[model samples]
Target chain A: MKTPVYISHPGLVTPLGLGVQQNFTEITNGNIAIQKHSRTDIAKEPFYAAMVSEAAINEAFKSHGAISEYTKLEKMMLLSALETLDNSEVKISDKTLLIVATTKGNIDVLDKDSAFNSERAYLPNLAKTLGDFLGVTATPVVISNACVSGILAVAVAKRLISSGGYDNALILSGDLVSRFTLSGFQSFQAISDLPCKPYSKYRNGITLGEAASSVFVSTIKPTQFAVQVLGDGSCNDANHISGPSRTGEGLFKSVQDAMKEAKIDAHEVDFISAHGTATIYNDEMEAIAFNRAALHGSLLHSLKGIFGHTLGASGLLETVIALEMMKQELILPSTGFDTLGVSKPLAIVETIKHQPINILLKTASGFGGCNTAVVFKKVS
Target chain B: MRNGALFAEIDAANFEGFLKQLYVMLDCKYPKFFKMDTLSKLAFMGAELLLSEISENSSEHKRTALVFSNRSSSLETDRKHQEAISSHGEQYPSPAVFVYTLPNIGVGEVAIRHKLQTENAFFVFETFEPEFLQKYTVSLLNENKCDQVLCGWVEVDGNERHGFFYVVGRNGKWKHSAATIKNFFEHD
Candidate 1:
């Protein structure tokens, strides 16, 4: 029998707040962190986004004292990982692996006014720096598959542990809202003028955000809360580079594969944490995919409204939030979603409710037509 | 395993001509080839040369996975995208250039070309590690997550571009092992 991987102690630093408890409180309270910002460094026009404050980041690092030069993004990643590793028996030894997931790590370094070296912009270099900070002895792995990077990192970690390559894996997923990313999204006309209303009739586009979230994937069960990674799968749409597949082919297949691997029926999934970017095509495609997969009736929610689309960080961060929700046995409403928008109908959670969530499925779809689905079961 | 490999080192000045030469050599008619950025172009040409022999079947396509890695990620297109937006107050970002700024788009290009709806992953390492590549591929196969996998390193550094793509499956003359992959890249 293969070793089972359990997720434990997820650390999150988002615009919502630091750590899981604070973010969970805000999420359950139906509070949103997205706000309009006119940062000259990001864009000339005012863009609505969820941005982690520099004060919060500096405050998080103050207790650790100064280390050598580390960029803001690096500091965010380190702080989140440190929070997850604190008071844990897990050791950063050779048996432990590090997987850093991001779309554009340190892309802000590309700016002419930036002081950090351009080399730090490389994903592998960023991974190495994070590995060194954590004292990981093995070569760090970097996953940069657009928005799916974070959720896919968890899948990769689970597979590695199941394959007996490592006993534990530290998975950190993050991305910052920089001029580069903002410009790219604007170019695609996928940026929302207002807070994104995912799967809503009036939804326009995504509200970008920045965050760093960490989850420790290990074979050993934790003393506290944890979830078992039952199964995971990824598929490409083979359709478009930027737009989601019109037929939702990749996502449907990915969900089917994950369910098959988990040896469960669609009815077994108590709830779903979906990737609802609120873009017309993406949300519509997800609805089509979920319907086709027979998950249309499941209680589903997208956390994008609370934490605007966090790009690479969305997948893992959302998973972490789902874990907390599972422990609380509460289903948070899909904020910003009011009316059904897509062609196919979906059971978008519209009200916060205290309900038992035994098995939850997390799915993410991103640019380059990538889709990933991972199924997790609550530990009793 | 049924496998193929190709490599190209453009003179940097005539990179377009080199790509055109590859297009002619492969006898491919995909016009989208010219629209792709440099990184996608390299990956596209490599996939064409590597997967040219595999027959297309609906079920087989679903069983094949594309796993790739690189050192530069998408630096080539990133610089261009950055240039477009920051060009002396031009502030005009091209949607085309912005789309290719992510490294995994190369895998998307190949997936679109061949219609591969299988498991795909892209990793970034300082340098190519044969062991990681081989182990990951084998794990997928062992778990029955995939029946076949096309994986290797595709890198683009300035004027220099190199790609080593090979197919691994139950049927093939070349064995899918770390040493074999190392030998294939080392041979050229």
Candidate 2:
């Protein structure tokens, strides 16, 4: 029999709050983080985004290490990883692996007026910095795949641990809403002016957000609420570098492959944590993919309405939230969703409901035509 | 180069010129080759050279995964995008350039060219970690994720261009191990 991997000890730092419980409580109480930000350093015009408070991050990080030595993204990532390490019994050792996931790390350093050296923008350098801070001896791995970097990191951790390469793996994923990303999204005209309404007919574009989340994957169960990493599949559409496939070919295959590996059918999944970025094409494509996978009966919700699109952190952040929902036996609603917009219909959750969630599926699709689907099962 | 032997050396001035000359020598007809950035061009060239002999059957393509790593993660295109949005330039960032800002786009470009819809991952390391790559690719194959994997280190930063790509399969003449991979990367 193959070794089973379990995931637990979620650590989150987002616009909503610091800890996983805090963010979960805030989302349960119907709170959102996206707001209008007129910061000239990030954008030329006011844009809506879910931004973590720098003041909060600085205050929280003050107790851990010297504040000036780390970049904002590093501070957020370090704090999240520290929480995971402290809350769990796992210890850092030569066999322990650290995976850092991000599309752009310390990207602010590239700005003309930045304080730090531009070399910090390199992904490997950022991973090394995090590894040193976390007391990880093994050479850290960095995944720079567009937005799917987060959960894909988790999948990588599971594979490494299962392959007997590591005792346990700590995966930290973070990305900032900086001038680089904001300007690029603006160039594509993909940024929304209002809080995003995913899967709604009136939805216009994505609302960018910033966050850092950490998850520990190991062969041993870390907590009672720990979930088993049943299976995962990542596929590239092989169509466009920037745009998602209209036929949802990659996502459809990903979900199908994941479920096949997990030895489960479409009817077995209780709920889905979808990558609903509130963009027209993305939502439509997801709807088609879900229908194609025969997942129309599963309750689906996109946390983007609450956290906005957290880029690299979205996949893992939403997966962490899904785990919490399974533990709490509650289904969170899709915050900004209204009428069904996509041509194919999806069972979008509209309100919080107490239900037994045994099997959960998390899916993410991002730039470079990449799509990832991971299946998780609640431990009883 | 095939089997560590020089197939043909192009006489050109710079990296771009060398790529153009190589493209002509290879007789590549794909128009998208001209639009890709330097990183994607290098990766594409390497993938084309390696996969040219493989059959064009879609099922075979479906069982092939693309595993790539690099030191500089799309720094060339990132510099261009940053310049456009900086105060020094017109502040009009082109979507085309911004799309290639991520290192995986090069992998995506190769996937699109070869129509690979299997597992894909792009890692960034300080230097090439052959042991890690060997283990990870083996695990993917052992786990039945894919039958064959195209794995390598493709690093392109301005004038510095280097790519080492090879195909790993269930049956091979040479063992797919860290020492062998390191030898191939170093000797080439």
Candidate 3:
């Protein structure tokens, strides 16, 4: 028999707070942090984003001990890794395997006017820097598959841990609102004016956000409260990269496959963390998919209203927040959820409620019809 | 905790020619009636040979996985997505071209054609993940997500394209040939 991979530790850095503990404290109380950018080159259209202030980030690094000058992207990764190790009470040693996921891993370095002209690209160098900081022996596996990069990073770590190739694995996924992504979204007109109202009637578009979350996976069982990643399946939509399938068949299949793998009944899921980008077709397609999955009555929420869309980091960060919320036995309120807009709205979680949380279906969809849903259950 | 697993090999030189040989092998295995297109040629060819025996089956093929990794952004479609929005006067951007912008959509193309919806992932890195294949396969199998997970390299270096994959399952028909399993890329 093969070993089962479990999430031994988790850490997150978002608009809410820094480190795993602070993020959890905010999530449980339903503290939403969609703040205005004050000023930017981007239009006032959807100026709201879940921005991790520079001060908080600096403080996080100070808490970690020392810092370096690789790049902000590398710093985000290192900070999250430190928080994860601290929360898990694990040491950063030469034996650990660190996996880094980002679509634009050190792509920000390209904006430095050096990568374009110079042969010194930062991605290859950034991974080495992150690995060196953690004192990891194995070279970090850097994955950058569009939006699914971070989610796939977790999936890859899960696979590695299950194979017992490594005793402990860390997954760090982050993406900021760079001119590349920010402009791309603007080019596609996928941006919204207000903080995205995921399932609200007359919802317009998505607000880009930045986030980084890290989690540790291991074969050792947890002695205390932990969320068991029962099952998850990632697949390409094959429909269209930009336009989701009208049928939501691929998304539907992902949820179905995950439940099947986890040996879970669809109805057993208590809450759904949707990839609610607030786009017209995306939300519509999601509603169709959830209804088809018979998840009509389950509590559903898209924290994008509070955190905005963090792209690659959104899924991992959201999953971490969801698991943290489980610890407090409290569910977060879905922001901008005034009226139910979805054709088949699965009970949109409107207000924060304290309850006996058990199972959660966390899902995300991105470019390439890449949709993934993982069933996490509170280990009994 | 790793389970019994192995690898398969594909020569990554002159991808088009390699794909042609792959097509013949796949056509022989499945005998499909549809004519193939250049767009689906490379991906379909790789997916076909990777799961030669299982590709012919139409039912419950989910247990047979399809995983690929590559760094070359889909330049073919990437260029097309760029060209279409610029050229088309009234038509919305060609969704078809915009679709393949991601390297992993190749996995979707194969999954839909083979109807193998079991377990799949598109991994991207600067270079080969070296040992992630066997490691990931064991995890998926142990988790009972797939009967046998397939994984390999799928990239377009230049005018050339390359990809390789093999199914991994525990069938005791053959002996535990550690030598063969270890030397797959060399001889298989």
Best by lDDT: 2
lDDT, candidates in the order shown: 0.87, 0.90, 0.67
When summed lDDT is taken over every stretch of 10 residues in candidate 2 chain B, the lowest stretch is B53-62
Residue A235 of model 1: what lDDT?
95
lDDT of 2 by residue, A1-380 (tens): 88999998889999988998999999888899899998988876788999999899999999889999999999999989988887586677788888999988888888988989989988899999999887888998999889999989888888888988788888999999988999999889998879999999999999999999998899887656769999999999998998899999899988998899899999999999999999999999999999999999999999999998988889999998998898889999999999988999899999999997999999999998999999999876
lDDT of 3 at A272: 92
Q: Order of candidates by TM-score, top first?
A: 2, 1, 3
- On residues B60-91, what C-alpha lDDT tens digit does candidate 1 reach at each position? 55578999899888987898888877786766
Task: Show the lowest summed lDDT stretch of 10 residues, model 3 chain A.
Answer: A113-122
TM-score of the second chain for every model: 0.88, 0.95, 0.67
Can you give the lDDT of residue A257 in candidate 3?
79
Residue-wise C-alpha lDDT for candidate 1, range A1-380, written one tens digit per residue: 87778988789999888888998888766688899998987787788999999777887787774633788888889889988998875667788889999999988888888888888888888998888877888999899999999999998888878887788899999999899989988988988889999999999999998999998899878777768999889999999999999899999999998899888999999999999999999999999999999999999999999899889899999999899889989889999998899999898898988998989999999888899999999877
- lDDT at A338, model 1: 86
Candidate 2 local lDDT, B40-111, one digit each (tens): 998898888888878878454568999999999988789888888896454689999999999999889988
Taking chain A by itself, what TM-score does each prediction score?
0.98, 0.98, 0.91
Model 1 clashing residue pairs (backbone):
B1-B172, B1-B173
DockQ for every model comes to 0.77, 0.83, 0.25
Candidate 3, A40: how far from true, in Å?
5.7
